[model samples]
Target: MSRENSLVSAQWVEEHLDDQNVVLIEVDEDTSSYDKGHIRGAIKLDWTTDLQDQVRRDFLNKEQFEALLSSHGVGNDHTVVLYGGNNNWFAAYAYWYFKLYGHQDVKLLDGGRKKWELDSRELTDEVPDRAATTYVAQEQDRSIRAFRDEVVAAIGSHNLVDVRSPDEYAGRLLAPAHLPQEQSQRAGHVPTSVNVPWSKNANDDGTFKSDEELQKLYAEVGFDESKDTIALCRIGERSSLTWFVLQELLGKKNVKNYDGSWTEYGSLVGVPIALGDEPGQADGKSA
Candidate 1:
């Protein structure tokens, strides 16, 4: 997917608010943010509950996803526009899910809620009521997803991007500073993975950086765009943004999001784990 098709500006969203072919949805890190106020006519999807499987660590299956979207009045042909707080981290996560389920037309609201609020755009608590439709979701697409084994196999062969903070990359912190330091049993990152924090992809206003800027940012980190890439964070939300940057915006074909990420990898039995800031040796020792 290209930037023109995968991203929409807030102004574009505002103009399309009344378009029957468009569906505006909000998915936020703070689940309560949508209840307070959102773009008029926008619907809320609780990332923690709606998208996740309550019984397992994975996402909702095809039938479940279909039911959920159908209940929300999303038709198969509608264009989905997702936006949210925290620089659209969770929204990007939702975007990944939509792609995984083979949604033909989906896009992110550039800059998301943070930029909208910064520009003093109008927000409302009122929710729109629409009739439900039959929404059929395709089978999961494995192309954009990376499993734990693929992450381990890509140690030195492919580009494994550790999209966590510097401290987290060095094993000084388990999760983002704002989040509780918990989840994985181990602390360090995957062996031979480059440290490129996901926040670098965005501007201070929460909008994504230009393609040229993003290309330079990744290039400076020794990123080889030609090789297969797996992007990961503690639980994969942050890395989804990076995955979007590499695959959708930058137009790379071999990029995947390792959704299990550090939480699953770090807890595994006897996998190589690297510590310190540098991309350590494949043997798992600090460089």
Candidate 2:
């Protein structure tokens, strides 16, 4: 029984426990979570260490970033399957990064590892000791990612999506968790961004809403789904979740995740933003 357009079930993964091509990468806030208990044969990749190649602040160096993937046994040929032992937080981050670096086949474990454990799936505490494989990371695709400068430049050129909540998009709210800052850096959003909360796509169980619901939901926000949309959140992780849904699920033509997200935008001096019912919100020129 094939899932609509998703990956295998934990039951199916259990049966294919020995399939060589199926490489499971359990990405959690801490890689040690993988050492505690995970799918019997999964590999542990901590979000900070393996997934992100942090610069002095929060930037990624292309060369160094590519090297990390090769060291993690994630080569171009590998059918990389990513799941988060934690909430889908960092798993979506890694999933987005893998695709940006040119690995088209990388797939997120639908519903994440939580769904698997809830079913009493088999797990192992012992860490797998496989030799790291080499991956030749292709040049990063600049199109699928957006930085502060790019967002500023593309203000009116293309569709910019603010995947954060209404408050955050308006600069009225600080972060998704709503942490306050003393300095109060760059407050608004990209000039042309439209508010489309990334969390709106998921149900209470954290699974994606039905495609029909998503279609109407996206359309309600002034998105066509067929057009190119660049989604951004606090740090790009949440928006990546949207990217996965749009590109892989909705079969969108040119959906990109602004991995730099609000962390990069909100700090910049002039990017433009909206509050409540502004004249030009991310929904193109206001409602």
Candidate 3:
């Protein structure tokens, strides 16, 4: 990764295509997407399989996550660049997941494969190879995330950011990832949490906007670039994107992700849920 919080341009990624320590991933929620085509030298990680711990539905544990990275030649010193076949959604989430496991030298492929392929970038249909290796887990950063208990305590705090869609925020459309009964406990958002949906930071094709635009976008939602913020979504993927925008794009050093997400929180019945107020107040829910 670069020395500062900013995206690596498409041109930059292309220039380092052959660098050994650089690992590229083409994420597909479905395997068919990767089978069709992907960037040359890009390995595929089926998000539903490789990137997550299935039973947990959260990011993999440090040991498993580190092993997966090591197998792909990723180390604390290696530069891991991730992209996606389905827009940049899963790609950015992968970036956020690795970061949560405390990997610092990682980056997102700006514009993802969509923009790269549109620009006539080279691609490959060959099977990927890997050299199995052991990777050490760096100390995890917990501040960038929050569990239900911590979030409920933030009733008067203004640092939590809910990166779910407006409809989800309003309790109009709950994420199907969770069972319907689990959705009933909390109908809105954590008290005081801002509705800065992850999708708003990117364009239609899943590429992020210019930094100037990002500054204003986040500022309008009351998330200054320098403030300490915790991002969460229905699961963790959406908030991971928010973590990327805030920490990597806008250069916010204090941003973190709530990896437990709704999958974990929604199951915690009566653990303090708010409807209208922000995260800490527990006065309201997402709606």
Candidate 4:
């Protein structure tokens, strides 16, 4: 199966379980989910620990990333499949990080854990023991990623998307009560960002909406493939899902995910932040 596509169905994953070159990883916001049950032979990666830099509020450096892959027995030629809780929120973020670090073959398990459970597929608490492998790390690709400085510079030049809740975007809430990590010193979106909650791209079953439905949803907010786009949420994970939808699923050419997102932008000093609405807002609003 070609890994060029960003998603694979549960049945597809099941068929590939015995493939020697396939590696399945379950990444979740809540790491405890792995203890209860998971896909057989699936290794667990905690979003907060395995994917983040402990010293800084950033992603793992090349060496650190290599260590993660090596410890998990993931090789450069292996196809990495990721799925998790919360509608694949962290799974998509993992996908974004792998792409940013130049992993050539990465895919998301469509519908994530919800679909797998719903299908009554195999689940196990047994952790697989595999020997570590030496995995090569590629040069970081910044094109698909956004830093704070890049975001500030792109404020007026590019299409900025705030893929967060209306209340958070309107400066009414710092973060959802369940996501304390997203809490920032300030609230509100970057100036000129359009609000488009990430949930709009998915269906009730945790699957993605159809192409026509997706196009219409994005078009309602002036989104098109002609312009460059940067999507952001409180901590950047949710925005990664939106980035995947627009860049890969919708086939947009130059969409980037702002991994620092509002947590970095809203907390930073000496940067202009807009609350409620901006001039000529995509959708008029008062807060």
* Candidate number of the best TM-score: 1
Model 2 C-alpha lDDT per residue in residues 71-93, reported as the tens digit of each score? 66656787777788444667877
lDDT of 3 at 162: 83
TM-scores of the candidates in the order shown: 0.98, 0.84, 0.83, 0.92
Model 2 regions more than 4 Å off = 1-6, 30-32, 57-66, 85-87, 178-184, 225-227, 277-287
Tens digits of per-residue lDDT for model 4, 1-287: 22247788998899998887889999888889988999988999998889888888788899999999999899999999999988899999999899988898899998999889988888999999868999888878888988888888876667888888888888887885575544537877787688888889888778888778887988988775567899999888899999988887888778899888887888888787777744233222332
Residue 75 in model 3: shift from native, Å? Answer: 3.7
lDDT of 3 by residue, 11-129 (tens): 88888878887878777555677778877677887788887788965667888788787777666777888887545767877777676677777778877878887888777788668
Q: What are the RMSD figures for all models against the true structure?
A: 1.0, 3.5, 3.6, 2.8
| Higher-scoring candidate on lDDT, 1 or 4 | 1
Q: Who wins the lDDT comparison?
A: 1
Is candidate 3 or 4 superior in TM-score? 4
> After superposing candidate 1, which stretches have Cα over 4 Å from the reference?
182-184
lDDT of 3: 0.71
lDDT of 1 by residue, 101-131 (tens): 9999999999999999999999999988978
Q: For model 2, how many clashes?
A: 4
Can you give the lDDT of residue 224 in candidate 2? 59
Q: After superposition, how far is residue 9 of candidate 4 from its true place, in Å?
A: 0.4
lDDT of model 3, residue 179: 35
